[model samples]
Target chain A: MSDFLMFSLVPMTVAIVICMSCALLGNFLVLRRQSLIGDAISHVALPGIVASFLLTGTLASSAMMLGAGVSALFTVAMIELIRRLGRVENSAAMGVVFTSLFALGVLMLEWNEVGTVHLDVEHALYGNLESLIWFEGTSLAALVDPRALSDLPPQLARVAWMGALVVAFVVAFRRSLVLASFDADFAASVGARPTLVGLLLVVMVAVAAIAAFEAVGAIIVIAMFICPAAAARLMTDRLASQVALSQLIAVASAVLGYVLAGYGPGWMGLGVSLSAAGMIATLSGGFLLLACLFGPHRHRREALST
Target chain B: MEAWWRALIFDAGYNTSLVTLGAMLLGGGAGMIGSFVLLRKRSLVSDAISHATLPGLALAFILMALVFGDGRWMPGLLVGAGLSAAVGLWAVQAISHRTRLGEDAAIGAVLSTFFGLGVVLLTVIQSMAVSGQAGLTGYLVGSTAGMLAAEAQLIALCSLLLAAGIFVMRRDFLMVCFDPVFASTNGVRVQRVDMLLMLLLLAVVVIGLRITGLILIVALTIIPPVTGRFWTDRPLRVVALAALLGALAGYLGVTLSSVREGLPTGPLVVLACFVLFLVSFLLSPRRGILATLMAHQRFKRRVHLRQGLLAMARDEAIFDDLTMRVLRRQGFIRRDGVATPSGWAAARDAEHEERLWALYRQYYPEESAQLDHRGLLPIERVLSPDTIMVLENRLMMGRGAHP
Candidate 1:
């Protein structure tokens, strides 16, 4: 039982931390009218992972980080380019860029013959927590030397670093992000560079994407990124409260999903990932439905009265 | 390359032939309807409906396997997709009306949530691997390599009938799109027209799903119309052009994918539509960027030449020399800014011209004598005082002045 807790439940604790970070960042993204930007960025990150492996001969976190950032930035640039040059609408531009990038990524993956690259791609999709728990460094040294202070596994350490960075960036630039998100024209009139703020937000998305790619695959990351914020939006009018509630929902869903998947299979030989990401999305949808049915919002009353 | 192309085009696999024709006919009809959808700004509705139907598909598959066996599942899947899409549309409208979240947000919410539910349901279904139900998984990603002839015929017949319906109702559709309020005022039954359009949109989405898959079917319904926009401003022309482009893209997309080992034909077709868009953006006569720029330049030149001619007429001392110089430079004026003898005759004719008089009045209304003193009046004015009589003749002919 302790072994199960250590291996399964403990890893889920890490998932909860990651989901909270995703939710916090996602709230601002959804409010900014770029809800699916996360989905686009995650899919576009595939080629970046492949490229990084080709360059470094290792699936190092730093290399993947740099690659994912470039790909995400490229996706944004392509969307802007399509809009400006082709005169296509925003949704159309989004569809064109992301689908093209995803197709290109698939082509690249197929062309690249490296076995390790394929593994990295798989990890980028489904995440490999079992492998993530092993790292070679101070933690390994501490394990050998009893007198030394114990250290967390390298994967946990990496996740903590990512989570902390996301928290710090959000806190530091919350006001600017909010200004640009709500009324970009007003922000620009008031001397803020909405473009720079937008770039900063994209960068935040890229960073969060890379961090979560190892835990949840690309397909599910969208759920983690958009679901919590969408759910929170149904519950609150205030941006701050929405962000807070989103994080809470995300963390709670992650924990519940992990526990359910972990325990349910034992009772009935039905092993499922509980897909922490999928659960968060499902729960967020449920929350939105609940709000639609029972919330005190005036629109609901008007719709019902009609 | 040549051999591969031949193989792709000539290969007679039952599924390949059926899927291609089915997708083309259905996708084309959808593209035609989608033209109106794009105009109405509801182009993304297809995407919402497609995603919302996933759970229904999964549930239907599960029920088929458990209750009646799975050899016959197409009906179940179609019913599932149809029901879900309808419900999804209603849900979208409900969310938009019942929340301050806005239309796009409501759409995003409905699409993702329903899709997530579908995924959960799919996961459950996949865990219990009942035979014959296994093939349903291919629908998610789409595999045109396995389409049956009956399915193809169904798609073609439905699409053809629908296309005919659209043709019959073209006038009503035009009135509905251009001015629904006016249509209603004229007893057009706007609500029925709207319902018909929505039902058509839903049918197109379901039919297109077999080829494009649920995730990307919106491209078929949207890209062709958008590409059509660049080529024509007339509604009929736009719809025709869009349908043709949609069919062309579908054909090329399938053929190309067959040549290339693993390219997804749906996205490839979308790429082809975008290519059409690019070509039209660069070369379309009226709306293309290059054409507009050229037209603007020509207009500016015309304005400049007219201004120079008016200036020469106002100054008789420089009139001959200026006319020569302006004509030499403009190629229409001759080195003598004069109309030649043609220049002299043109100047004489200009003396009684009402437009010239108007220009004169606009610039020097109280200086008619000054103009004569300055030699701006044609020699005919001095040689034949009848010219002033002719100017009065011209003024009377002008009849209605800017009172």
Candidate 2:
């Protein structure tokens, strides 16, 4: 148990917090019909982090976040520009911008000899979750030690603040967000500034993406940003309850996924642990599948109401 | 640099020639197919389909390793890739069509989850007794540096077939993309054609997986069609031009990467397509950014000139700087803002047209909806000679009442 606590607990907590923040943002993204923006942002964040590493010559988290934030914003602008200028559909424009930028990031990483560093493509995709061990917490009692608690993984603290920030943003602007999402012109008529709220939501998603990226990787960030919230979206019509249920779903998937990835194969005589991020994503997908199959409000709005 | 020039025309070497030929064909095929995909508003479906190829590739690799001790056969892996991509497409359709989720949400979910599951299976592969499991991850970002002759041949053959497939189905694609209900009404089998389009796209993707990898293959599919859209308005022309541009990108990207030894072929290909896209976006004749800006400038100039002439006819000062510039540039006014001879003449014309327009609108109230949109053009440009004659006579007759 102490071994489990020392080896797996902090990483699991980071994963859960990351999921919570991502799921919170996903609720609004799904409702606002920009769910794939998370995927685009996560893909483009690769170049931003790579560019930051190239410029600063360091692995500082704050600088990397700035880089990822700039790229995410850039991705949004480029997608919009392409959609407007190229006369392409929203998803097609998104596909063009994110894939082109991701290719550039990969090229940048390869052009330089950054392959030997900790910032390879694999690390960018799968993250450094497994290696983020809490060295200060040696035994179970160290969990109670204030020094050990203080010295817990920095990602845990980062993801916690990110969760709080996302929660606060959503709570503070809940009415505007809900109103704008349901009807942009109606909300605009009532002084909601739907465009500004949408921009802010993208910003919050970028922040959450950068926060979760290093711990759970880009795949899980995309999965968490979409699956739990989407599943919860089918669960209820009310926004508050949907948000609450998504967080529940997020936390559940993260914990169960972590446990399963760590111990499931061992119990089945496979004798090797699986990837925690991949497992979390798979579990979230499973939850969404179930929700699609059995959720009461799984039909379209007109179908449900009329 | 001389070697670069040689490589550009396929005179570099045997291996270089093979890869370049394969890449050019693949790029053309993707660009052609992507044009239809873009027209259908399902360009991102390629992203979902490509990502879903991972588990299929991994599964094929493991199965082939178990059976043949070498899981790197190009045909088997591509077959596996094509199958999984079709499955992913079905899942996306089922989710969006059956459940309440939007297509974008469905795309995101299927891609990430399928990719994640593939990653789990990859870990399983790593634990197996395979000899050369180290190279499987290349399907993600693609590494063209180690492609074999047989793989290149397979890619070339598939690209040819996909191009043919898209060509044969172009009419059906047009109908289905433009008006699905109408197509179905015409017995076009919209669902089956849509699936065939995706099937052709996934085959191209499976072929491209060896060249650009799953992540960047989407770039080839998206950027080329977007670039093509800028060049022309006709969908057929867009398809042809996009294919040409895709071929050019492939040729240039491969040759340029050959010249510059350190860069990977996939990014070079993508970057090449991007460069083409950028140039087309800003410089293409039909819908280029420069053309649009110039069109806007002309419109602005016309508006300023019209308003300034009206203000001059009303005996008001043309205080707006743009209006003054327009008047001065067109020799309608002097530098000191005094009306020149032509300026007076233009002002008289403007006053007469304003009156004539009022007479027409007042007399032909029913036709005012069409006449209300009259911009900078003179009444001669819009109305027939007979109508203008009648309108001019009415303007002359109503002059005393207006005064």
Candidate 3:
């Protein structure tokens, strides 16, 4: 039990927080027809972190976060510039920018031998989720002890704040965000700044991605950013309820996925642990698949246009 | 430096030359097929397709290790990658069609989930303690440090087939990508052609995996096609230019990576593609940035010069600095802001043209609306000589009526 407490508890909670923040902002992205921006940002995050490490010569959380944030904004600008100036499609523009930047990141990673510093392509993909153990918090009582709480993995606190920030942003701009997402032209005519809302939403997504990236890796970050919200989208047409359901789905996926990854193999006599981050992503994808098949609103059958 | 030069010209040994040549061919094929993918608005689908190959790769590794005692068979893995990528494309199609989610959403879902499954399987393989798994990671970023003759030949032959297939079906691809509805009406099997094109694209993705890696291959295909767009508007020219650019990038990038000790092949190849894209983006005569800016400047001068001439004809005080400078530069006005002899002649023509326009507008409102703006273009350019004469008579009558 102490082993579980020392190892799994903090990582699992951190995973839940990461999922919450990602799912919260995903509501806006999925509705606005920009789900792939999450993929692009996460892809570019590898480069951003590498560039930051190269510049700052440290892997401090703040530095990495700032680097990722700057790169995310850069990617947005690059995609916009290419699309507008080159007259390319939006998706194609995104593909070009993210892949080029990602290649730059990979080249930098290989050239500089960041391997000793715990930076590699595999780490960027799956992350160090399994090793984010809370050594000081060995027992259940340690959860309440101030010293142990203080010693908890710093990622937990960062992800928690990001979760709050995302929830607050969603609650504050619920109406206009929905208006802009559902019908940008109508929203613009009605005196709302759809572009401004869209920009703010993208910033929130970048922040959430950075917050989750260190814990769950880019793949899970993308899965969290899309799967829960997409599954919830199939369940309900109401945007608010959809957001609520996605949060629930995200939390459930995190807890269940963490448990299954840690203990499922033991129960099956394999006697080896699996990756929590990958398991979480896989479970969330399963949730989405299930929703796609059976969710009440999956077909949108009530629409007369059909 | 001599070694670098030798590598540049592909004077490297037989094995190195084989790899370099294979990479160049693969690049050409990717660009050829990628041009069609871009025209069809399915460029991002390549990213999803590449990422989704992971699960199949891991599964193939497991199967091979279990049966053959070696999981490093390139053919087995490429086949596996192709199958999974096809499944990924199908999933994207189904999700977008069956659910309310857009294609972008489907791409995100399929890629992340499939990669997740691959990662999970990879961890399982790690726990199994498989040997010779180091090369498996090479598929991610690609390495040319150790070249095999068979692998190079396989890549070369596959690329040749891919390019030939594209060459044979070029018209069908162009017709389908440009206008599926039109092609279908003209008796083309739109769906079949689209499927065949996708199969060709899958081959490009699978074969390019060793040279450009799966992740960077998206840029390999997409950047060249976009670069090709900068050069020309003709569809066939765009296709040809893209293939040439891709081949150059691939050939140059592989050679350069071979010159260095630590440099990886995939990223260098992508960077080469990006350089080509950047150069064409800034330098092309028609769609490039410099040309667009030059055209805008030329149009601005015409507007300013025309407006200045009209103001001089009407004796209106011209306060716009651009108009003043334009008029002064063209000798339409003196340094002291008075009209010169040639300036007066030009102003008289302009004044007469303005009157002609006013009469033309009053007589033919519909046609006047269709003309480019109002005053910049001369009346003779748009109307026939008979129409100009009629307009000139109307101008004289209007002046007489007013005077």
Isolated chain A TM-score, each model: 0.84, 0.95, 0.96
lDDT of 3 by residue, B1-403 (tens): 7877898777888877988888888889989999999999988888888888888888898899889888888889888888989998898888888999888888899888888888887887787766868777877888877757899999999998888889889998999999999999999999999989888888899898888777788787798898898888989888998899999999988998988786889999999988888887778897777888898898999888887887788889989888888889999888888888898788889888887888889899999899886577777777899999998788777779989
Candidate 2 global TM-score: 0.96
> Model 1 over residues A11-121: C-alpha lDDT tens digits?
665677778877788888777867667767876787777777677878787897788778888888977865765576777666556655554454455345553444533
Docking quality class, candidate 2: medium
For candidate 1, the per-residue lDDT at B140 reads 52
lDDT-sorted candidate list, best first: 3, 2, 1
Give the best candidate by DockQ.
3
lDDT of 2 by residue, B298-366 (tens): 888988998999999999987799999999999999999999999999998988887888787888888
Query: Best lDDT goes to which candidate?
Result: 3
Worst 10 residues of 2 chain B by lDDT: B368-377
Q: Count the backbone clashes (under 3 Å) in each candidate.
A: 11, 0, 0
Worst 10-residue lDDT window, candidate 3 chain B: B373-382
Q: Which model, 1 or 3, shows the larger TM-score?
A: 3
Native contact fraction, candidates in order? 0.17, 0.73, 0.75
* Winner by lDDT between candidate 3 and candidate 1: 3
Between candidates 1 and 2, which one is better according to lDDT? Answer: 2
Cα RMSD for predicted model 2: 1.9
Model 2 bad stretches (over 4 Å): A301-306, B260-262, B370-374, B400-403
